[model samples]
Target: MKRMTTLWSYLLTLLLAVTVSAAQESSAQSLLRSEAPTSLRADKTLSGFGYADRNETKFNYIGTKKDLGSFLSEYIKLPDVGVNKITKISFPANKADAGNSYIIILSEDGNETLYQQKCSIIEGINEIELTKPFVTESGKRYLVGFATKPLGIDDKDFAVLPFDYGSDIEGTSYYASSIVPYPSEDNDTFTLKSPKGLGSACIFVTLEEETRLQTLAYIINVSGTFDPAETGKDITTRFTVRNIGVTDITSFDLTYQFGTGEVKTIPYSLKTKLKSGKTGYYAFDIPAEGDALGAVHFAVAKVNGETNFFANRCLDLPFRIGDTEANAIPRETVLIERFTAEWCTFCPGADPFVNAAVKSLSDAGLRVSYVGHHLDDPFAQPESSQISSYFQGNGIPAMAINRVPQGQTSLLMHPSNFQAAYWTSKLLAEKRGVRIDKIEQTITGDKLQVVVSGVAFQRTFDPENLYLTVILTEDNVAAIKQVNGGANYKHDALPRLFLTDALGDLLSPAADGSFTMTLEGTLDAKWKREQCKVVAFAHDNLKSSLMSRRNVYTAESTYLGVSLANEPVALGQAPVVSAEDGYLSIVGDVDCFELYDMSGALVTTTVWTRLDPGVYVIRIFSNLRAYTSKVIVR
Candidate 1:
């Protein structure tokens, strides 16, 4: 009886030990997860930095410019000090048929090759799983690098990695271009013997382990249909959210804070199951009150009752509330950016088509403005190249309408679709209360001065995010070696100069929602003053998915040197300009006024009565019109 009892106790102890071991094995988890992205923005563009050539190899590291410095061999210090396995690599490429590429991982000191693998390249996003996963060590930093080679077809076939110029990383990207390919697993050398340049090529690695069952969400886009809110009315905003996690998103919460107001959290329950890698639209409403000008920003606060920093995306929504009537016609203007080149065979045919489209819009009682950008041609400028890359104008004879997001249409498209695209955007474009009230253009000697004033028909909510972009375009200029068209072909609306940054310059408006800016640029000797026109437009850096990379609210164009002083003046219609009691008052419905000296130099965009007793040109600008008259201060 004693021996049987002992045997039963031993069997029970063994069974308990086996159960505990199984529980421990279940607790140690492994899940597929991606590292933090080099750029968090949804949009990326093809960079004109350089093109890959046959027999040429380029090595690059995606990181801040400060850390990369002038050296080609730069390493990113691994932030996490734990056991993690890198199983896959992903990146973006400009060309679909790139020949060969490789992903390399170097040791902390950059003297040893930890892991390397050859990856097949594709046009958009390319994902490659490694043959053998690299296990990371604790307290050891690793540097990730990529090497690429061009197709052997021709020298300039336009093959390179798509770059993200707007990355929020610490420093600029670093690269080394070499005539010969670097040997694989060469730990003897730490630096490359090639010319170096700046370019960002983002690469995301897939880790095999992190926290258990990670949940991530990416905010894809926001709606652009949010109109100006009426005072005391609730304004609704909608955004598209995607489940980028391994697990399904059952519920989530979004938080928004308008200006200095209190942050409000709104919870959302997924009626339909949002599986991994799927997207859904959610809407929320907030009361529009108390603030006149401020930004409304939203973020993903929590997912499934847990949160991570990567879940929230930065989205800027500029809001406005009007004190006027609830329903008002939005001041609409169509902005066209035409991409062309002298060597393009089909580009000349696109000119008349665009003009016809513009004329048709004008006939329909719509204002249309356009600017031509030359690509890889003699007339191409740095600003033109920059703008082209930002908009991803990969091909010639492309046009963008109003910069509003099209469902699947690119920001730049073929000329054949310009009319249809324009109409599509016009029909769905959000109504903006902003308008260009007045524009003043003056040419003195070798310089051109422009003043653009704007006003909101309703109260504005965000003024700081409001921006204005001014461009000087020349008309009827002789084409430089036209390819399809004859030598007599004249280029119209060719971009001559950008008075502001290619994107725009921020605006600071008055309390009454009135703003003004004065821009001056040196006139090129080759440019004809009479053929030049100044184009100014108001746009906001609104972080909405429906809006393109940028959206133009309203745009206005005026011919240079064609001020009211050059035309026949009507009595009483002109603004009454007078200088009295140390105050310069222009009694009229003028939105803004500027003072210019007799020499055609701009003095001020504000009312200034401190001028000495002398003859001055007072230019007053109103909605859809401008007036110029000579005034004397005694």
Candidate 2:
């Protein structure tokens, strides 16, 4: 009797310990929730991305090409489905892994492997329905993923499938290590990781955009130059607001952060409904904070009474509140980099405009730089792709004017008025106080050395505030083909190496506004050694400012900043561009000019036409190069 009682007590204690441990683990895991519930709703599929193009039909793998026995995963917050009714788990399969994949469910912490669907070949998306489904709880994030079975040395187990780590569905991809007990689900341990950059698993989850009563608001952009004033003094600054949602609203909350790390929110109550797609100007009359060199400002917009997504899309702006007394010079050289590809159909037209913009700006005799980043094609190497990816653009014809992605001509906007755009951006960036001197590059054998120095005139380039970035680009790579189907294409200013990081590098910020740095790199055999040029720039890490002047390879100016002078500014008698009334009249000396719709499709136009009110990119070309502009035909 004594022995029986002792055994029973031991069993009960063991059961209680397991229950408590499970509860603790569950609590720890629930922390992995997504900020948005769009993908956790019932009856809605979370496959590929929310975009139709990213469904199972498309195949772009996330991990190393298509290696089987490897893991491809996404962190998903599974919604509550009643009594084990959430039966289906589906994902696109690259034809190779048609019948040999293990569907898996991992714990939130990704420390334990909970369940596995063995031989769960995703025949088609939603084709393999679960007979006895694994139950999921609401508000709990889980890893819903798949791992391919390793083939017997001779076979390839991995194949292409849908994956998108960028765009609206950003929180989806999570990296997972090799599942323990490789071919078996019996092993209960694995690690979950966040993908690098926007990440690379070609995966998406289907979720409703609205979980309950959620509406998204975006703080489109804030643009204005601050006036000369002292810190601690109140200055009235106005910003433009846009209603991006379908429903009109009456009130909005604007938040801007001060240099002192204080965040201030201003409320704007409107008398009239600010309809969707409409923009209105709003102001915040508040006292300025921080010193004369300038205080970096971050601004965000949110709808009243709603926790919308606008808060995440805030803008960081560094502007001086007072006169330019401390700073004496502007940014010396502005680099205009256009992220383009031969596969981009819109690039042909965009190239002319971009080059023309450079031409127009350089015509003023300003020290402007241009690099055409040929990407997504054979003409450009992987380093060029890295430079393109650093900016994280979703579309082509992306331009990073001045190494720092600030100012007007960024990838977000169309390449319409390259000339005016570059010039305007140059003027704005040139006002900064920094100078680069004694820039020299020595290429010995396969090793290259770049030595340069910088001096900040107005403020300090301290480690807390600044970093350095170096890039190498080559001219005349000799284009093999073109996206517009033209054989006569010449690729120029292609990036061969990022001497520093693709984005930037950490440097000891100068105490007295002066600094020097040395960078070394190995030349790739495939790269044209003699044609390469070094491009270096100084940047303010804290304020996100690109010093107006940079140290660049000074050997050759392809455009010579003098291309426009040889040709007449007019086509026989017509002005380069002019607008009167509702019609925009554009004419130039060229064989032919083309107009394109925003979609990049070619459209027929008659130079001057009575058209609908909208934005348009007009490309006027001459034998030397093309001039582009965004004309608002109102």
Candidate 3:
């Protein structure tokens, strides 16, 4: 059996490698936020970098200064936020030359000059720097390129050739002109070519959202309800705090209120810094009001006392502990990313199983967030290939269940396996004591307005930094040609647009005051507006790889909602729940359950009295999960 022993050893080694890889995935996610600013490429609204159209024009002649250096220049429409500074300009050239004079001029949509700077170029592919920076307001356009003197060298590339990229859409070519001095001439003799609707320069500039700070708070988990029998005693309930911010959370003042009672303030000056995207907890032994049992309790926050980060900032949540039946729901969100391509015949086999699992999870009250990333598919997006980079695979039909168990991409296409992955993810998420609450979306004209809110439930847990991504996905493309599924593929949850950064908008502790955000979306005509959905999530971006791809945050994570062992547990599954004879009883997980009237009023007393009840809703809970049931008392 020596051969058998060797095979067993090999299997064990493979298992060990898979385990190590899985563990490294989550820790690796923090790399995105940890990367240096200079190393990561900045996100720009308008980039001439993608050389989609290769209409290369050779430099013929350089005109006099009065003509504004017209040998070669690529004018582009600046983003709505306009241009800040043309940091670096890379121009591909045909040949090398020393001290060739060059100039970069900015104008308003092929209009008069707004800003102009002339410099010298070297050889082929030169990165020219502007002597004086140019800045302009939103809704502006500018021409950015180096106008050079006649090099006299034939068949050579020159300045402003196109930023080394291809097939990616960015901007368009406005006009190309050849004239003795053309601001005076207005005829066909001046216009040479225009790659209208399908052109962009080899330029890159900072966008609008790039400047705003992305620090905010998420209320993860709020647990435990008020009890009346523990009269004159300190009744306890706890909530979690997750610091999803850029900087550390050092100090803050918190205000707590139980139901409609008097407000109590608890302020703390901490010795240790609470880093970003980490979870923490707070427990309160609120003095029992004995009689005022069914009122709502919550916490309101005022952040680190920084005015710039504090304004328009708020984080508040009101929840019931063993009180309201409606407040006991703590469902988890499962992110499922499937990697496939039309070329892979077996890829279609996985989709049916995965989608069926999603339905089962939904029916069970679990939120399943799913997306299919196309690899080598005709409908593939650049971001789809980027999504594949998160998981390890060389073949098709691979799936990532919340970025867990990496190196396990192959094998198994069954609904039960899908359910297992989803439920396991849900369980892990619930264990983290995190919760996403209150998502509001409104579509006005072309702009879709959205607001998202959340909170933490365990002890404070964050890494070096954190960011939150809000996504809008459209369902069922309807006409996609599928090789295996059918002629038409009902694509499930295809990502259409990102309200924030694909990498994610930064979140900070200052947002703890209310931990809410508002985003406006300008809908694309390609997306079916009626079938669109919104998904938002937060993660540690400190060690993230988003730096390389301009901060496009990939939700295909391996470890989400890190488990918090010491935190409270779900009370819904408590076995000792019983209600009989017009009296509702709750013990271990809950002290008691309260009955609400038809007008949404609490009608209860501890005198053990019989109710003249018709029907009522009973709300019960601790901190984790809750269940509400209807009962008729006669």
lDDT of 1 by residue, 551-587 (tens): 6777767667644232323456877878886468777
| Per-model C-alpha RMSD | 19.7, 21.2, 20.3
Off by over 4 Å in 2: 1-230, 233-289, 292-321, 381-394, 403-413, 421-430, 460-465, 485-488, 540-634
- Strongest candidate by TM-score: 1
**Candidate 3 per-residue lDDT over residues 205-286, each given as its tens digit:** 3222333222323344565544323445665667665444445567655555654456676665656665543455777665
Sliding window of 10 residues with minimal summed lDDT for model 1 = 47-56
Cα lDDT, all candidates: 0.58, 0.49, 0.44
Per-candidate TM equals 0.50, 0.44, 0.36
- What TM-score does candidate 1 reach? 0.50
Per-residue lDDT of model 2, residues 483-540, tens digit only: 6747767676777777776556765635676667788888887776556555556655
- Give per-candidate clash totals: 6, 24, 73
Global fold similarity of model 3 (TM-score): 0.36
